[model samples]
Target: MLLFVIDLLGRTGPFSETLPAGIQAVVAGSAQKAADFHVNPPPAAQCASCHAEHFQDWSRSSHARSLTSEGFLRTFPQYLDFVGIRAREDPQVSMACFNCHAPLLKNADSEIIRRVAAFVVAKDINKLDGFEVGCVACHAEGNGVFSGPIRNPKGNLFHASKFSASYKEASFCATCHTWAPASIPCSDVYSDWKKSRAAKQGTTCQACHMAERVGITAVGLPQRKIRSHIVPGGRSADLLQKAVALHLKAAFRQEHLEVTATVRNLTPHRVPDG
Candidate 1:
């Protein structure tokens, strides 16, 4: 039955009403638990005041728009419908979508998940307006602790700051970028990179997505190699165009034309990766 469901999902996307009873029950149970969980972090505005440059860059990134983007808004409902779940009736089902898009809520207790799911189902966008993938989502470690890659960050008057080596590693991005939920490979970019030459050379997701820049992480801090928050990905047409090189060769023989093209992927991961 599990194999059957997986096969069916592969062919039909995530929107199938004929999923096995047991699978549906499992999904439903997970949804119930997710609906009950709820956690809220500090707003982006709080971070903006101190890390102006980082905040500004993030404001224009896809991470900031993850939840509210038109693509996500449209696809989320289709996913729910495919899985035979309703946002209002079984808000827990939406947890899978929120796990990455809204990590803050992903940590929430079951009750809070339910409450927030209700708001989502009712289309009450304002209720969770400021709680999308904001600055605090990745930087803040629950409560008030904030973390980053800087070893010895100096001048920070607002909140508690800490240095974490993990921030500089590619595994940090695996949390979301390589996550496979419900037997579906959602974003396998990290997995692809792990097996790539880049990983062997100690290259990390930050190396590409968050390119380095000489700037202050926060107010009153010295200039340093701070990772930019621009976070470009596959959607970046300019980046994509430059990520590969195409070489073409043509020959004519006996009134016949033959062409050979060699494509090289400049990036570590697979071309057209998520």
Candidate 2:
């Protein structure tokens, strides 16, 4: 029985392809049930207990409010309504929006899924508190392991720790920042960066968002400089000021007033990116 459980856990290579249709359904249903209930991982507060500064930084970031932001709260349910209307025509309509907004739902238990679905369907913006993108969404692996860019980290007693080069690279941000749905470019930030001189020069997303800082990563650990969690983007005033240059010239040509304004993009990619 132990070996059977191990085999089930290790079955990641398309086992459904070899199973009968009824058996496949049963297996899929069982897997979904397990995902919905058995995956009760800890909340973001657990991480805050050890990394208070990082937690505080993240709390003020837009990422912390990805799901609860007024703009997102207004449009998300309308999107769900559109999906519901079109779902009958194409039952396989993609629901990829949740990939970034509600990352937890990727492995949420059935009860959580039902509650979120109900809130979205009813447009109940008030009750959706814990559904936003949280710390574990980006740092934790599927098996409940926490990872970061720190190599040989110490003083961690909460969970297993490991160094992931991807955390320091641009491709990590590309997972969600670059996506095309139904051949329509929803977000092309990652691709834009790739085509820009920044990518050629080895500039990464973390270089701008998660800027370096000198501080302790955890309690009881020596103070070492590390990438900060106060990740910022286009909305950052300092970044916007540095990304573009504007100049205005006024003159009189042939007794007629002529004014010219010049705007130059200092950044590699287009400004005001979506």
Candidate 3:
């Protein structure tokens, strides 16, 4: 029985391929159930619409592909294997993985929660997605924000009430926009800003990234006002490249053995450091 459970936990693979039957059923079915909670799908707000240019930049950025990505996932199996970590089988653990990758759903039931307990006992839990980060991943309704969608607050027609000053405050992003818990060493751009002079100036993640310079839709849709929904975190490869020019130059000690690394922070708090 112990070996059977171990094997069950070890069944992790690429997100593109079919997951284990049990996991598939739970993820797909539970995701649909969570969708049911939203009676109204968010309508295209100012920035809610797609912005090809911004998205292209963001798509090339690391923030867009935090975990739910192939390259990113490849590192995981090897990293966990190196540390002798096993995969988790508990539903709560599953939910937590989904929380960052597919935050649109939940598996908060007792039975599944117990699975989290069991998985914790086994100490083999793995993350849910590769390139797990996406546009709506962090800029969504969750993240403990009272505003509408975190990214395109204005364009999201469903949450008309969110068009307020509180949504624009930097504190609104402090929730999950920062770092992961101690167990996870994920970047925390939010906290960095909180500690910097920017925080004193009251500059927020949205002000710089999603700030409304002019009323324009992401896709150039003619709206009274467009919220910048092109959540470009990691996809802006060019911008990232430009930002890290100094680091790349510095790393190339001899331009031969130097590994030019370009780092781009999607958030202002940890802009390049992150």
Candidate 4:
């Protein structure tokens, strides 16, 4: 649960027929059920067909690489064995692990689960790379539609679109990030955020990670407020540098020089955190 478990874990369309600013497109189709997303979910490439830019930014994010990330892949088998050996029962390995890495695993066909588990058992981790936990994980929810802060005005004949306020709230992230809330354990990122100055001042996880930008999210969309999907964290050198500052001074004594150093934290929350 230390390095491997905790490290895991956004994105448009159309060109002509732009609608008025802040107006969502009129839907000609009913929404799909959540079941549609939970089983054999469409890959990010499907969404990339329309929302190219958002998909591009998302591709660079850790979310895109969660399953195949070298660090996690190297340790995942150990984790599975640890759990299995301890429980000594039918270990629903894919269900427990993929809940965060690949939500589509839940209620998936038995064959899909078997193949994924087989890959894990054989140490053929690379096979899992093509299996993407894409748009369905966050945007598709109980509402039976893909959602965002702003819906694409030039709607597609494809899936139904809707606007959801949950996309604008940090708690939406807690869906996966909350490993232990009451105990405020290392994995409880939401808890850490609650104690942060950013939380007190209303700065959200999206403010620093997703970075606000004004641009067309999809091909036909007009320039409106949008967030980048880059989502940098401690692994980003520039972001880490910005989180803290250091100062030093020296003074000459009668026979020697004395030096003093100070470190100042500039971030809303703790640095070098789990």
Q: Name the candidate that leads on lDDT.
A: 1
TM agreement with the true structure for every prediction: 0.75, 0.72, 0.46, 0.73
lDDT of 2 by residue, 150-243 (tens): 8886733235777898888899988778875653335678888899888899988888778888887875667889777777777789878878
Span of ten consecutive residues with least summed lDDT in model 3 = 1-10
Query: Tens digit of lDDT per residue, candidate 4, span 1-274?
Result: 1111110111122313343321222111101212232223545655665576788888888888767777556556666667676322333665566677666667566667667765655667555653545666777654346778874445654456788877878887776776753422226677778888778988877877888887767667677777888778778997887777888899999989999988887776566773
Tell me the number of clashing residue pairs for each predicted model: 17, 2, 33, 2
Looking at model 4, the pairs that clash are 12-51, 14-220
lDDT of 3 by residue, 75-143 (tens): 444444444534343344444444554343342454444443343334322422211344434444442
Residue 46 lDDT in candidate 4:
50
Candidates' RMSD to native: 15.8, 10.9, 13.4, 9.8
lDDT of 1 by residue, 1-274 (tens): 2222111111212424464344454334333333322213444644565677898998888888777777776677677768884454564677887888777776566666676665655566666654577777777764346788777766433346788888888888888887756545366788888888989998888887888888977766677777788798888887788788989999998899999999999787777755
Best by TM-score: 1
**Per-residue error at 249 for model 2, in Å?**
7.6
Give the poorly placed runs of model 2, Cα more than 4 Å off: 1-41, 85-94, 109-111, 120-130, 180-186, 247-262
Looking at model 1, residue 193 earns an lDDT score of: 87
- Candidate 3's C-alpha runs over 4 A off are 1-67, 75-86, 107-166, 180-185, 211-222, 234-271
lDDT of 3: 0.43
